[model samples]
Each structure stands twice: as C-alpha cells, then as structure tokens.
Target: MGKLKGEYIILQNEQFYLKGYKDFANERLKIEDYRGNIEHIFSTIRKLQKEDYVHKTIVKCRTKSVPSFLGQGYMLEGCIPGYFLGGDAYFLCKYHDQKRFTSSMWVEEDKQLEEVWKKDGDIENKGVITPSIRKATTLDAKKLATFYASVFPIYPVPIDNPDYVKDQMEENTIFYCIETDGQIIAAASAEINMAYRNAEITDCATLSSHRKGGYMYDIIQSLENELVSKGIFCSYSIARALSFGMNAVLHKSGYSYQGRLKNNCYIYDKIEDMNVWSKDLSALSAGKSALSAGN
Candidate 1:
C-alpha cells in the first residue's frame, strides 16, 4: 500500500497477518472531508480486490471517518480511547470473504471461560508449580512455535515456523516465557512501537497442561516494567473477548477497558472479537518530563 493522492497512507502487508490491509489517517488529510476521501478509499479497495491482493479491507481511522465508512458498507468493529495522543481510533472492516469469516468454537469457549474467571476470582495455578519467567532467545524459537501450534489453529503469524519466530525476535519484538523442568510452558511478547511510544502486548500462549496459572499476570507485569524503563509510555492489548483468563489478567493488572473489535482476528479455528485494554505506564513516572508528557 502507498500514498493515494497524498492525503492518506495505505498499509499492506503481503506477509501473514490477520489485519493485513488498512488505510491510516495521516496529518495531511482534512478530517472534515472524510466522506470524499472514503470514495477514494473504496476505489482503491476495488482496485486491490481486482488484483486479488487483499481478501478483506480493514480501515483504522479517527472518529471523523466513521459516518462515511458506515455509509459505504463498512461496519464499526471497535474504538480505542487515547489511542492517538488524546483522541480515539475506530476500527472498521469490509469483508470480501464473508462465508470464511464466521465465528468458531473459541467464541463460546471464551464466554464460558470468562464466566469461570468472574466467579473464581484470579486464575489459579492449580496443582502445577509456578514456572520461572525470563526473556526468550533464538534458541527457544522451535519450542515457542510448538507451544503456539498446540493452542491456536490460526494465528497472526506462522508461529509454527521457527524461522519466523527468530526473525520477529531479531526485529526487537521481546518474547517472555515461563519455563519448568527446562521446557517452555507459556509465552508472550511485546510488539514495540517506538515511534508512538507504545507497545501492543500480544501473542500470548500457553500449553494446555499449563492452564489456570497466574503466569500471564506475572509475565505482563514483567513486560510492563521493561517497557516503562525503556521510555515506552503506553502498553495495550487486544485480548480475546470471550476468554475469561486473558481478560481477567489484563483487568487485574490495572489496565482499563477501551472497547471491543468484532470479528477482529482468525484464531483458534474461527473469527472472534477481541477486547481492547490499555495501561498508562507514564503514570508511574518519577518526575521524567518525557514520561509525564506521554500521560
């Protein structure tokens, strides 16, 4: 994706991605003229569709474009408050593969899991001993892929490939893992956005045998601390909305609810909505002007 008339930036990732094609709101565009701009966007989408470059188009825009997008058969998926400095960001999607974009077992599983989390309080470690948490290295790539494949049938990236995992690690994506008996049982990562002073806490996975442990919370806290120390101001996650354990971990860890992305990703063999949660790391600042400014 490239510039379409110098007003907006189209982003397209040919590589494996869930939300691969999108249009971003740039500074040059007049927000009030979004209706006209959307026509250009639709034209671009049609051109891309004809070439078979994208199966679906996901548009992320400021609130100004919501009305125009809605008028053009796009549906609002979610909104994230303070996603762009002090403003909000909206997610909209128009699918060309509607039949393939339906829900699956993970949807119902999430609902049931959430109910259990609400009633049981924190996720228990059950009888398994707490695993040791540490940063992952390239050597852990194969194990990481295996763990991910065991949990998710479809993920954003090909986590079943060790080479891909290694590339991501080399690109500054930090992976943290919980290990026991010299084996990795759970893992997660912080996708850093240095230019925006934020990070998306994503790619969380654990082996089935390691369920119901507080390892996620521990890993999240550890990642947050690392982010804050490195001058990252915000940490956010798009968690499966139906999963009680993931949502509970974010909630208990002091993250505030933002909104929900409907049919946002293909995971666990189906399309599912994801819950948006964010934590303000700048609030923990100790008189650092840069950190304070981020708040």
Candidate 2:
C-alpha cells in the first residue's frame, strides 16, 4: 500500500490529500480495485462540481508512476476524456517480451460518450418498440445488472448480483428497463471517469423481445443528442469484434475507427478484440443519416 498525491481537498473529512501512488500487487487496494474508495473521492468531487470545478485539470499516477501496477490516472475536467487526457485511466501489465519494461507498462485509454444532436426533436415512439424507454430509477439495478450479464460476458466485481448493480446505479453508473409488456429487458449507462473528462457507454443491452425494435438505437440517439447539446462531441467506446450489430450502430451514428487493441477483451466464449471507435460531431456530414451503414 502506497499513497496518492494531488491538490485534492476532501470536503467531507475537511482534509487535503497530496498526490502519490498506491501499490496493490501485494494486496488488494480496497474491497475492489482502488475505485471502491469512490465514496471518498466523490465527497470532494461533489463539492467541486457545485463550485464549478469542472474547469480544473489535475494529473495523477499510480504508485511508482511508470513501471507500476495500475499505471497512472490523470484528471482534467474540462477537456474530452481519453484523447485529451489519454493516460488518465489505465492498467499496467508486464509483457513477457524482453524489450518490455521490467516492472510493467500502463495501458489505458479514456473513453467517453459525447452527445451529438437531437433528430428533429424527440419522437414519441421509435419503431416497433418492445421495452419502453424510460429514465432508470434506483430500484431497477438488480434487473439491469442481470441484463448486462446476459447480453455481454463482462463479469463485474460481483458478477450477476443485484446488489452490485444497485451499487452501480447509486453511483449513476447504471440505467435499467424492461419490455413494454413488463418483461425485464434493456439497460444502459455511462461509466464516467471524471478524473479524465471522459465517460464510456457501458452495460448497454436490449433483451430478445426488444431486439430489432430500434429501442437501443433510440435510447443511444437520445443520449447522444443530449450530450451534443451540452457541447460534448467526442467519445470512445470498445466493441467486441463479433458484435457486428454494435459496431454497425456506431458507424450509422458517425463514429470512426481510430484503431484496435489486439486481443485485449474477454467476451462470452473467448477473448475478444476490442475495437475502438470515435464519434466526431464537429464534422457530421449534412443529410448523412447512416455513415457506417453506407460504408
């Protein structure tokens, strides 16, 4: 266990913390990864947000900085995540190759959801909607978590436990839903790394009943529109190579393929390739409805 340093003022404890690093290889940082301490982090951030600290930018690193366990994490509030604060959130890994660093190298790219624009105002209904689109309340966490576990093979720290989903929902990291007929279904949410001014769209799913009904598309489009109106035009998301449908959605919405992290993701039956895609609202071709579709 090491330490972290920065000009962080913990509002709840009435204390100030200096930036440093913490080592977890020999021990578990918290109940989970260091992120479990988010309650403490949010205490100060919540106050900062109230005071408009969104403009402040701070660089931080894992213990040992370079050649460390979790690598380094930086925080710059105003700029877009991932690109601007490219090294903000990452995990370090030791490559067996002789040329690799002795300890390890940090590898993480901040990805965020950038809201694009409203399509001629919201339509009361999207085509063949099965699960109704609604804002997820705290109560829906259990179903939401289960939906994500079913759709994609990502096992959270708690896997399919509803309590874990509830925890995530409480942290604004989850949204939930079900079919219009009341059958449990779709879930979506933003996994925000506030330290990097970036957020990733995670746990997005639509159950079989809601499939092909355009519910997921509509919900994502709405979120994008909201972000675009707020001036957040760039975001990054990773999709499994086999998830052609997900990739197709990003393409239709105007996301470009920046690059890929070879064989770096775990999907249901195998280790999957992570496809990195970026959406640039600054240059949406006029009258272009489906950029990825035509290409």
Candidate 3:
C-alpha cells in the first residue's frame, strides 16, 4: 500500500485498489478533512477493487490521528487510516515499528485455518455466573475504568480514562459486567459496527481472584447473545496472541482462528501481535437455535 497526494492504493498480485478522499466521498472530503465517513469511503473502494479481481480482500492501515473511536479502541496514530474492505471485514492495522512512511501492506494470510468446537445451545446456559452478569450503565464508567486499569496494563491508552469508554457508550457499544456481592469483579463489552454487520468483543478482564472460574466464558456467551439479538451475526477481536486463557475461551466458544497480524499492537513499549480472531455468530446462533428446537 502507498499513499501520495493525499490518496492511498493497495496492490496485490498485479491487481490494485485505489481511491482518493475526493472520489471516495464524491469530493465531500478534502485531503485534510477531519470528518471522513470511513465506512462509506471504503465501500466505494471495495466496489472498484472487485471490478478487477474476485479473490478475498484484505487491507491494512497504519496512520496517525485516526478517529477518536478507532484510536481508543485500536490504537491507530500519526494520520487517519485508509479503509480496507471485502474479505471477512475491515481492520485498521498498527505497524510493528515506526518506518519513514506511516503505512505498509500485507496479504490476508489467516483465512486458511478451520475452527474447532462448534458449540450447542447448552453451552450458553452452562456459563455459571458466579459474579452475576449485568449490563453496564453510564453510571458505571468509573468502576469500569478502575477494572480496566487493574487488569489491562498492556492497553495502549491510559487505563484510567473513564471518558475513553464513556465516549464509546453510544448505541454502537454495549458494556457489561460480572459482579460479586455488588463489587464489580469482571467486565466485557461488545462494540457493534452496524454498518459492517459485525461486533467487536473488547475490554474483557476479570479480577485475578476471579480467574479460572469460567466467568469470562460465561460473559462472552452472554454478550454474544446480546449482539445476536440486535442482528449482529459476525464478531471479531484483537487480543494478545499468546494469552492462553483467552485463546482457550474463544476456542471453546467456536470462534474461528484467523491468525495473527504480527507485531501489530503495544503492550507497554514492547510490541505484540494482536491476534485477529473472528467468529460467525450467525452460524453459532443458528446452530444453537436448531439444537434448542430439537431438544
């Protein structure tokens, strides 16, 4: 991928997708415009790219000063990112290190792996909520911030910014908790990209004492169902590639392994692969529904 004159292009196997902010937004956004509707902008590029090739598509973005929403969630920087579309979903990639250019490109490699543990509906109920699960309200921001601070020391943004999550509390995101005797012990949230028809599972953390008790798994399933009810059928997450406990939970829950974007994020100055994992939640819901009907 390369950017020049305030536009970006990606070349793969002699086929390419390119767009300018002008053409992308029909001249609505100038080069330095701040309010780019990244979703619509990428959809236009994907349309043109498909005109040339039929293979699965992947686009990676490295930039500074991404939209606050993307920045807080994914840690994009320096410039606003260009859009990637048409494969499974769009992702903004954080480069492993700083190069002279703000961005680079990579092929989509993870589509090769098959997933394991297709769960039955019973798996949903099997989640014993020792610390009961509940939807988080705006009032819970401070508590949520505190929980994140204690657990996600590796996150790129300061963990204490209650406003960070506060800004994400619009219709797009649903934050929730696993609480014990009224003290919040664990937390998770799903951000639904209504435009993309998908959900991003993020901010999952449990108190150390609460670990190994399956609360996280229970919370994940519950949140998955919540997204499903709202018509989101696909879910994806970026997590530390080597987090065995999280990987095991996602694995058991039937999320497909889509491989890692090597050295894509920060864990306190040390970079790590933010493993890209996705699940076809629609399939999971359908399978569970069928199993339920049979029972």
Q: Per-model C-alpha lDDT, please?
A: 0.67, 0.44, 0.55
lDDT of 2 by residue, 1-295 (tens): 1111113232223343433222222111111113324446534433433432132222232332323322223211121224433532332232222321121211322222222122223332345534456767667666665666676554323436677666766663535354555555665665544444445665556666456555656666655654444444456566654565566566555666554433343345544445566665434422244665677
Go through the candidates in order and give the clash count of each.
2, 15, 7
State the lDDT of candidate 3 residue by residue for 17-102, as single tens digits.
33323222111121211224555444444454343121212233423334533643443211211121223333443222243113
TM-score of each: 0.73, 0.53, 0.60
Query: What ranking emerges by TM-score with the best candidate at the front?
Result: 1, 3, 2
Clashes of 3: 7
- In model 3, where is the ten-residue run with the lowest total lDDT? 25-34
Best by TM-score: 1
Model 3 stretches with alpha carbons more than 4 Å out:
1-87, 90-129, 288-295
RMSD of 2: 12.5
Model 2 weakest 10-residue run by lDDT: 24-33
Ranking by lDDT: 1, 3, 2
